[model samples]
Target: MKATHNPPTDVQVTPADLLRMAALYLRRHGWTQGTYYASDAPADNPTPPACVVGAIGIACAGHKVEHFADLDTDDRHTYLDAIAVLVDYLDDHYPIHLFDDDGLCIDDHTSPYSWNDDPLCTADKVIAALEGAAKEWDRLHTQGGEQ
Candidate 1:
């Protein structure tokens, strides 16, 4: 009987790097583009709606710093799959903690805790969402087949 060869295991895709890959994916897919500004929002406005900026920030902060640019094709796919999971979670859960910038706290009308208070929460949530997503991606890839 012939034995199947296992794929090489020299490459490793880190969560931080995966996040960066996800950010790039968003950019490639027109999911994120352009500079974002909040000045036009009403001074009393509670929260800025979710936007590409948050997604981009999530990708930028969550990706692996050391191995971001260097991944084999298989590794890249694994990374992207993980990123996709994170993106999906961000789209669904949209956790407020993602964008919580304690330093940005202003007053009662716009406390970070409020759901409608800040975009920073989006960024913060990406990190948390990616953690879960990465594990799922890794499992899917290791087990076989696309996730």
Candidate 2:
């Protein structure tokens, strides 16, 4: 998916490191649209489910999410730790992350929202968003944009 708005030559848009990481990790692992993980006990999940925001959480966090299910008993703390890390990234211009689709009442920060999205969100759209976001970040940085 291309950028919806391309600014003038003097302007640039820098995406975050997490975007690139999410893309790569999702490509290597797998993506889930509607849930934080594909399964409640995701350790044995063959695909190792990861939604857009979850991907960002797992990618940068030193804590292994393979055992993330076990921490569900303390879900608040689990998410809190992840949120703490996300806060650091938020201090910068992480161009695109998870955004809620007001119309659908679901969170889909990918570009698939630009299209019909009738069949349902797929791994392909997720990957496209990650790669596209990464490219956009690189392009903006090359043009003298700050990360």
Candidate achieving the largest lDDT: 2
| CA lDDT for candidate 2 | 0.52
The segments of candidate 2 whose C-alpha lies over 4 angstroms from its true place after superposition are 1-15, 40-47, 64-119, 145-147
lDDT tens string, model 1, 1-147? 337877778866565456555444444332311222244545553332223333333344442222424555655565445545565554445533333366653432221123323444443343344445555555665667465
TM-score of each: 0.30, 0.47
* Model 2 TM-score (2 dp): 0.47
Candidate achieving the largest TM-score = 2
**Model 1 local distance difference test score:** 0.43
Cα lDDT, all candidates: 0.43, 0.52
Candidate 2 lDDT score at position 140: 59
Instruction: Report the lDDT tens digits of candidate 2 across residue range 1-147.
Output: 468977568532124455666667778877765555666645755446677666755654533454444444544354444343334333232323344556443432322222213245567766665565565545555667655
